[model samples]
Target: MAEKKWMPRWFYQLASPRWCYQITGKLLPIFAVAALILLVGGTAWALIYAPADYQQGNSFRIIYIHVPSAILAQSCYMMMAVAGAIGLIWKMKVADMVAKACAPIGASIAILALATGAIWGKPTWGAWWVWDARLTSMLILLFLYLGVIALNSAIESEQTAAQATAVLALVGLVNIPIIKYSVDWWNTLHQPATFTLTERPAMAMEMWLPLLVMVIGFYCFFAVVMMLRLRNEIIQRERRSSWVRELISG
Candidate 1:
């Protein structure tokens, strides 16, 4: 007989809700600690050590928060869409749970980005709001997040809801590129990206370093939040499983 290849045990464990919950439980604390340290240290560095913009002065510090939130929001949505696709394709409950958990977090971060952008704009643009291409596309991203959240909640069957939301997420994936390229495609008041792989930073190391810290801190924070939410989703979806029952009883 020909030899048959089987997936590794570790891969199977990763697909298990119980295993995922346990792994996340171990990981959550590490990410939480990292998030706390980085966010606090980054905030202090950004506020106290980083020099002010000659033109914008202290107002430029808000970029530490705004840029990170905006980046995280887009990243979260992309993850959610990919998770949703996994659920749809593989019928993996864990992927559905992950997708479900991502929506509210992504929405909240998107809102934070928008709010901070508005605040940053007032000083730079002398206006609180503008119909800029980037701004409008970001707004559409927020709406897409809301649509997935609503669709999931509205469906009666869990599997049906997952499928519906997955399709919606896939459709909405088109908007992500629009948001990314909006500035280049159209002349907008919004500034270009601060950090790009191909281009050297325009700002001094003192300015960009704290911003880098804040960005890393934001990513750690997102991991912490998403793991917490994913753990809850696992428990909720797997309540009937023996591990969940034991966990609850314990």
Candidate 2:
């Protein structure tokens, strides 16, 4: 009799492209609906109900968009790098696909954060752009994302591309902490983190709640987008597989 090796079932399932595709198909609607509801409710609450900053006034509302996007950008990059690492270590095609999907979405989110930051800064800092530590690190993050995308595209072989991008993503992981702590490490104009796990928020509940909603909404939105992209990547890469052929024919 063969001895059984114990491992988490879901972890094994994640290695299956078919399972991933089907599971994400089931999950996509749930995330899409949640993202829609939370984003809409959160945006409305931030704009109408949340009290304005006494100093910044209505302009502070931009944080509702800017903060969530900024957080998501960093989070997505982390996910991408980790997924790439998994693909490299385990040779899981689904993980490689997930890493590839994360690049474009993260790059877009990074761009949004940068744009909103610039818009907010014009009013607060009396300048459209400044070479602040946090902002500079974030810009570097965008470049890292672009580099992964470009490197993957440049390679003709899929496996080679995945390997190359994974290495780049892993190398870029060093920047994540730098971006997070840039405000503390340097005397930049960028403000300190608004939300922290260790401390209470400095803002009122009315103001904090909507921001929280927006952050959750953004994460839901990211999940939906990532799953959609992942499914496509799976289908594209698995097109020759029997199950995929059956799925397509059906």
- Per-residue lDDT of 116-136 in model 1, one digit per residue for the tens? 999999989999999999999
Residue 191 displacement (Å), model 1 = 0.8
- Per-model CA lDDT versus the true structure: 0.91, 0.93
Q: 33-114, model 2: which lDDT tens digit per residue? A: 9999999999999999998899999998999999999999999999999999999998988899999999999999999999
Tell me the spans in candidate 2 whose CA falls farther than 4 Å from its real position: 1-8
Q: What clash count goes with each model?
A: 0, 0
Off by over 4 Å in 1: 1-11
**Which residue pairs come into collision in candidate 2?**
none
Model 2 lDDT on a 0 to 1 scale: 0.93
